[model samples]
Target: MIEVEVEAGAWTAALPDAEAVAARAAKAALGTVEGDVVVLLSDDAAVRALNARFRDKDRPTNVLSFPAPENAFPHLGDIVLAHGVCAEEAQVQGKTLADHLSHLVVHGVLHLLGRDHEDDAEAEEMEAEERDILAGLGVADPYAAEREGRA
Candidate 1:
């Protein structure tokens, strides 16, 4: 089973449906893992701070995932999402807010499962998995739209 503990209030409006989508993403991303994970949805300000502090990017990103520390009980890791960045990306990509958010949720979950896209090949593999999982959830292929000039 997968459990998600939300740490912020920015996603309260999308929480109900986001939880369902997040569960599906977790199931698809982790396969058979059994544990709990945390998802922190916050405004651009919080995310930007986290990004700058941890990743040294000095800017807010759509999502950031921090894996669980060694030997942690039932805690996989934490996923931090920036609401404003997500909304803007959704708008620019011509996808609904929920869909974009779902993609980011899945992306973050994949990271917790040890997935990485540090190179082109890895990114392609990860993107393919994301497309398959998101498609099963009735979300369009995020990369396909961009590749096809539909975004």
Candidate 2:
């Protein structure tokens, strides 16, 4: 089960089926693991606050994932998204807001499952997983366009 909490925002108007995105993204990566996830659709300020408090970045990021304890089955983790950041990124990346949102959710879920992109090798592996999972969700490979620029 996926729970969506719109923490003081009008996300329903922008994303009516927010929870669906969370559920699909998480399930696509979850595989055999069974657990519930909560998606917080919040504004930039909320995300920034969390980022500053937890990561000391002092800025809002696209998504933040918080994993629960090891023994928490049927309860996986929490994914938080910044609306302003995601929309701006979608516009910049040439993707629909929905598609971008789906990708972020998938990315966040993967992080909860121990995926990271802190280095080149790790990023390549994680991006491969993201590409495979997003493909299954009918989303285009996000990095394809970036590679297009180089080629």
Candidate 3:
């Protein structure tokens, strides 16, 4: 199950079908994984607070993932998205807000699935997976822009 909670009005205004988009992206990421995921659509303030309190980062990011404990079955984790940062990033990256949002959801879900990009090898592997997942969603390769120096 994927539950989407909209905590910010901007998300709705920016993407009225945000919840459906999130669900589709998350499901594409999960594939055969079995569990429940909660998605929080919030503002920069909420995300910044969470980032500071949990990650020790004082700034807001596009998305953050919190995985469930090892023994937590039927409950995978939570994915939070900051509308302001996401919108800004989408604009900067020359992508529609929906596409960028889907990509972030896929990235966050991968984190919940134990994928990390702390090293070159790991980052490459994760990016490959993201590209595959996003491609399945009809979203172009997100890193392609960076590779071509467009972003």
- Cα lDDT tens digits, model 2, 13-118, are 6777766776677778776767888888898999999999999999999999999888897678899999989889999988987788889988888888888999
Give the alpha carbon lDDT tens digit for every residue of 80-109 in model 3.
Answer: 999999999999989999999999999999
Per TM-score, the best of the predicted structures is 3
Q: Over 4 Å off in model 2, which ranges?
A: none
Report the poorest 10 consecutive residues by lDDT, candidate 2: 8-17
Q: Which stretches of model 3 miss by more than 4 angstroms?
A: none
Could you tell me which residue pairs clash in candidate 2? Answer: none
Of the candidates numbered 1 and 3, which has the greater TM-score value?
A: 3
Highest lDDT model number? 3
Per-model TM against the reference: 0.86, 0.91, 0.97
Q: Compared with the true structure, what per-residue lDDT tens digits does model 1 show for residues 92-113?
A: 9898878887889889988988
lDDT per model, in order?
A: 0.80, 0.85, 0.96
Off by more than 4 A, model 1:
1-10, 13-16, 149-151
Candidate 3 global TM-score: 0.97
Model 1, residue 131: C-alpha shift (Å): 1.0
Global local distance difference test of model 1: 0.80
For model 3, what is the alpha-carbon lDDT of residue 25? 97
